[model samples]
Target chain A: MAAFIQLFVSGLATGAIYALVAVGFMLLWQTSQTINFAQGEFVMIPAFFVLWAIKILGVGFWPAVGIAVIASLLILGLLFKRAIVDPMLKHGVLPLVISTIALSIFLKEAVKDFYSSQAQPFQAMIPSEDLNLFGAVISSQSIFILLIASGAVLGLNKLLNGTRLGRAMQATAQNPSVARILGIPVERMIMYTFLINALLVALASLMISPIYLAKFTNGDTLGLAAFIAAIVGGFNQVRGAIVGGLILGVIENLAAAYISAQYRGAIPLILLIVVILWRPQGLMGRAEERTV
Target chain B: MMDFLTSRAFKGRVFVLLMVGLIVLPFFLRPFGLLLVAMWMVHAVAALGLNLTLGYAGQISMAQGAFVGIGAYCTGLMTLAGVPYPIAFLCSGALCFAIGWILGYPALRVQHHYLAFVTLAFSTLVFLVMRNEEWLTNGIYGLTDIPRPILFGWNTGKAQDFYFFTLLMTSMLAFCVWWIIRSPWGRAFIALRENPVRALSLGVDTRRYTLMAFAMGSSIGGFAGALYAPLVQFFEPNSFSLTLSLKLLLMVIVGGSGTFFGPFIGAATEVLLPEWLRIAQGYYLIIYAMLVMVLMMFCPTGIIGLGERIISHLRQKKISSERSAQAQAMGQDKVAQTKSDTQGGAGQ
Candidate 1:
């Protein structure tokens, strides 16, 4: 019973992180009608950036977090304009897709080559306190990660439902041509989508800094998991991503705990394939038609 | 037809003869250098095989690396079981073809990026299996102590002899590819890639052709992999990762797809690019990835595309000059037309 409770809580936290990443994936997908394979690379940028800041700039955790988000957005703007938006102005999804894969490789290789050779734990940011719930023992860091992640979802929900710009984002995602006909600046909206996705990645990196040590390949694995969750949730739907993340997290944890750990990653992928074969759309996605 | 044969046919045959003469290169070239070229030729042949699917048929496959791994395993296992070297090599190709045909079933439904995802998954699964399946693969230690591939009554364990063996097999495959492309099956693949609906309307079975493409491409990869096991005398899961698959794609894209000689150029570029950038070793991977991007963007059609553009440009300019000359010498042009009328072949 205690093991079950322990699994449930940790699963929720991990799911929360996936949901956050999925949300970022949806943000870009929604606005531009293309998914960034480099989206997960954005997640690592913040963790590394903040780590760099705390060590070099000597800023406290909160201040370092603020600076990291800012720097990421600035760099994101440049890449969004130059690498992505400009060349892709008149192109199909193919070049953009291939370029993102290239970009992901670049980001990963750069981190591996230039950054610290050894993996570093966020000892400075993560508190070492233990919190016992019922018969299970949990960490303060785990609770904090969960709360912060939940808070982000809540805040994003409010922004999407309440703000004028948020409506413009939705409008652009729903129908780019229609939005253009209706006088919305579609390009600007897409640029903003990239910004928001990068910012979310920064936030996710900061939130998850406690438990998982950030390494060059950490983003690659997390990004793949989140991407799978995003697909399971439905490619373009934000709510679906969040739900998908939690469900996958629980399934993964339980599978790992009960079955073999070697094939832990394979469980969700198998489920995803089966679900896709059944639904052809996702668990929560709109039923899509195939031309063939 | 006779005139056509006498013209470029003479030149083309001469070129082939010259190339065959160059095949005696191992006598003069060092064994190590010959081996290097031999290995590059193997990859070149494999990439050409991939081009039939990825480039010509427009199916982006990521399991080429896995197929190579399978071929290597098959070769190693067969050799270990005391099978003859030639039979082991042929059996590896056949086994990989079967695997590819089975894989092509689900792969027919998926297209573009989604198809890439599934193929990528296959490669990853194969990688994982090779790492964890101790009984079969020895859990990443891989099959070692394999014997070298040899021809009948000929020991090809030496670098020079093995290089010639590899070269002969590669040349034979290259010729086979050329012959296959000249057939209706190759046309079907190209037609399917360019327009599936049109090809279907014209009574082409696209699914079968796609499967054919996958099988053909994968068999070539297997052939190369089979040869590679004995040549290197070692195998590991790390050697057949997704990175190798990506590099194969890069070779096809950078060298030129569709054209016969493009894969050779691409294979050369892929193998030599890093060696050329030896000084900037730390930035080799980043530079390589960036080069692929730039190549994809500017030369999406690859070396053939750029070359075609330049050749067409020159041809167009030359034709225009002749037309202008005719305009300036209208009386002489009229006399030449009468001469053609007297010659009786008016159809041309």
Candidate 2:
């Protein structure tokens, strides 16, 4: 029971990171209808930025993280929008999808070539101390991750639901032409979505780097996890992504412990197939009517 | 001129020329070159199948490599177990057809990126299974020394002999694809691609056609894999990874999706270009990735599409110039008619 609790808690922490990435994924899909195949790389790249700042530039941890976040927002968010997404989007979703896949390869290869291919140990923001809860020991890092991830999600929720900018973003998502007609800057709103997504992924990178390590290949698994989590929870809903991420995290940990550890990666994939086959609108998403 | 360029006679002549090239080229090349060209043919078969699926039917699949892997493993294991290579090859194709048909169920439910994810998940799962199932797949150790096929006392164990065999097989497969594309089913697939809803309204049975596209495409991929097993003689699960699938996709896109000759050109570019780019050493893949990104950004329709665009643009220019010349001639005729009318009226 204690072991189960431990697994559950750790899974929640991991799921929280997946949830953060999934939210960003959902935002991109909502506003621009882009399934960014390079999203895992987005999470993977920021850790290197943080690493570069601290190791190469001799910056402090918090300040390095700040530098990483701002840089990610500009390069990954703004540049990605202006360069890849804006140009390829008009060609339709398939081209955009191909472009993103190409972007993923580019990112992966660039990192392996330019940065160290070897996994680098990342510094944890929180001190490494065990906290006892209900006869299960939990790391302070996991606790910190959970707190920060939830806070970020709540803050994002408040931004989307409460602010005028958020409403404008939502309007653009619903119908870009109508939103533009109503005097909202549709392109700018989409750009903001990209920025917000970059911010979320950078945060996710910081939270996950210590646990998973900062590695070039980290994005392959992390990106797939986010996709599975988002789909399982509900592709369309932010809340669904959160629930899905938590469920996936807990399930993956349990499967690793109780089931065959070698085939643990297969578990989520099987879950994905089942969910796609049985409930494609997702557990939380609504069935959308074909617009045309 | 355009009619001649697109005519059956011209295509037939091109086909004969290509066949002659295939038959005679190996004589001048070394054994390694023979093997590379043979590998290109094998990948061309896979890319051709993917073209049918993604290009013709507009279904997105990231699991083409997985299907190819399934074909390879099935043929390798069966041939190892004393089954005839021909029988094993057919069985492998059959297996992929059934599996791909079942895989198409998810496609019926979702479209675009959702479908891509479903296939991506499938490919990953297949990879995990192939990597983890030590008892069946031999895990990371991989099955080895799979014997090449013998056809009517013709042993294709030699590089030159295998190249001829692969060439013959590729030509047959290409013929089959050509026939399919010219058939009513091909028309139905185009309809499905252009607009599924409209196709359904027109009673095209979009569901069955969708399933057929998946089955046929996957079986062709399986056939390619079967050929690949004998050609390479040794391959690990990593050979059939997502990278292979992406490469197949790259071939289909670069060559020109939906065009009959696109896969061949695409496969050549994929297999040979990297070899040519090996001068860049470690930076070859980075260069390749950037090239693909630029290609997708500027010419998503691919190399074939770009050629077609250039041809059409030139044709349009020619037509416009001819039209202007005709208009000038007509203007002169109009002036002559007016002068005659005025002269006749003055005389009256």
Candidate 3:
């Protein structure tokens, strides 16, 4: 029972990170119909930036994180819009999809070539300390990860649901032409979503790096996991992503414990297939009305 | 000129020239070069399969490499177990066809990126199984020394002999693809691609055709993999990763997605260009990735599409210019007639 609880808690912690990444994915899909295949790389690149700042530039941890976030906002968020997204927007989804896949390869190989191919240990925000609750032990780092991830999600929820910018972004997502006719800057709103996505992925990167390790290939697994989580939870709903991520985390951990550890990675993929087959709209998403 | 360019004669001549090149080129190259060409043929076959699915039917798949892996393992294991090479090859293709038919179920439920993700998941799953199921796949140590086949007393253990065998197989496969593309099923696939809903309204069985597109495409991929096993003689699970899938995709896109000759050109560019670019060492892939991104951004139709565009443009220009020149001559004749009439009126 204790072991189960331990696995569940750790699962939730990782699930939180997956949720953050999924929400970012969902935002881009919702707004621009742009599925960023490089999303895992988005999470990956920022952690390296933070690592660069602290190790190479001799900055403090908080300041290093700040540098990483700012860099992501500028380069990944803004420059990404200008260079990759804006030109490809007119072409349709497939071109963008291909470009993002190319971007992912570029990012991965760039890191491997320019940065170290070896996995780098990242400094966790909180030092490790074991705490017991209900006969289950959890680390302070896991607890920190959970708190920060949820807090970020809540903050994003407030931004989207409460703010005018959020409503405008939502309006743009529903119908870009209609939103533009109503005087909302549709393109700008899309850019904002990209910015928001960059920020979310950056947070996820920082949170996950310590546990997952900062490596070039880290994006491959994390990216797929986030995709599965988002699809399983519900591709259309933010809340669904959260629930899906938590469920996936727990399920994967449990499977690793109870089932064969070697095939643990296969669990989410199998889950993705099942969910896609059974509930195409996802658990939290509504069935889209098809129009001719 | 435009008519000749698009004529049957021009295409037939091009085909003969290519055939001659294939038949004669290996005589000049060393064993390694022969092997490279054979590898290209294998990849070209796979890319052709992808082109049918993504280009003709407009169903995107990122699992072609996985199908290839399945084909390789199936053929390798079967032949190792004393099964005839021909039966193992057929079995591998059959296996992929059934698996691909099942994979098409997810496609029926989702479209575009969702479908891409489903296939991506599948590819990853297959990779995991291939890597982890050590008892069967040898768990990364990989099955080795798989013997080459003997065809009617023709020993294909030699690289040059194998190249000829692959060339013959590729030409046959290409002919099959050509026939399929010209058939009613091909028309149905094109319809399915242009608009599934409209195709359904037009009495085309979109579901069955969709499944057929996937099955045929995957079976072709399996055939390519079966060939790949004999050509390489040794390969690990890593050879069939998402990277291979993407590389095959690059070939289809770069060569021209919908065009018949696109896969061949794309495969050549993919296989040979990298070899040439080995001068850049580690930077070759980075260069390759950038080139693909640029290609997608500027010329999504690929190299074949670009050529088609230029040809059509010139044809239109020729037609328009001819029309204008004839108009100019007619206008002059009309003016002279009017002048003569006015002169006759004055004389009267």
Off-target runs (Cα >4 Å) in candidate 2 are A54-58, B1-10, B324-348
Query: Cα RMSDs of all predictions?
Result: 5.4, 2.4, 2.2
User: How much is A2 displaced in model 2, in angstroms?
Assistant: 1.4
Candidate 3 per-residue lDDT over residues B71-183, each given as its tens digit: 99999998888888899999999999999999998888888877998899899889999999998999788889887889899989999899999999899988999999999
Clashing pairs in 3: none
Q: lDDT of model 3 at residue B268?
A: 89
The TM-score of chain B in candidate 3 is 0.93
Better of 2 and 3 by DockQ: 3
In every candidate, what fraction of the native interface contacts is reproduced? Answer: 0.24, 0.71, 0.71
Chain A TM-score of candidate 2 vs. true chain A = 0.97
Candidate 1 lDDT by residue in tens digits, B130-187: 8878888887788888888656788888888788788778888888888878799889
Clashes of 2: 0
- Between 1 and 3, whose TM-score is larger? 3
Task: Give me the overall lDDT of model 1.
Answer: 0.77
Q: Which stretches of candidate 3 lie over 4 Å from their true place?
A: A54-58, B317-348
* Residue A281, candidate 1: alpha-carbon lDDT: 55
> Which ten-residue region of model 1 chain A has the weakest summed lDDT?
A88-97
Candidate 2 chain A: 10-residue stretch with minimal lDDT: A283-292
Ranking by DockQ: 3, 2, 1
Q: After superposition, how far is residue A9 of candidate 1 from its true place, in Å?
A: 2.4
Give the alpha-carbon lDDT of every model: 0.77, 0.90, 0.90
Residue range with the least summed lDDT across 10 consecutive positions in model 3 chain B: B269-278
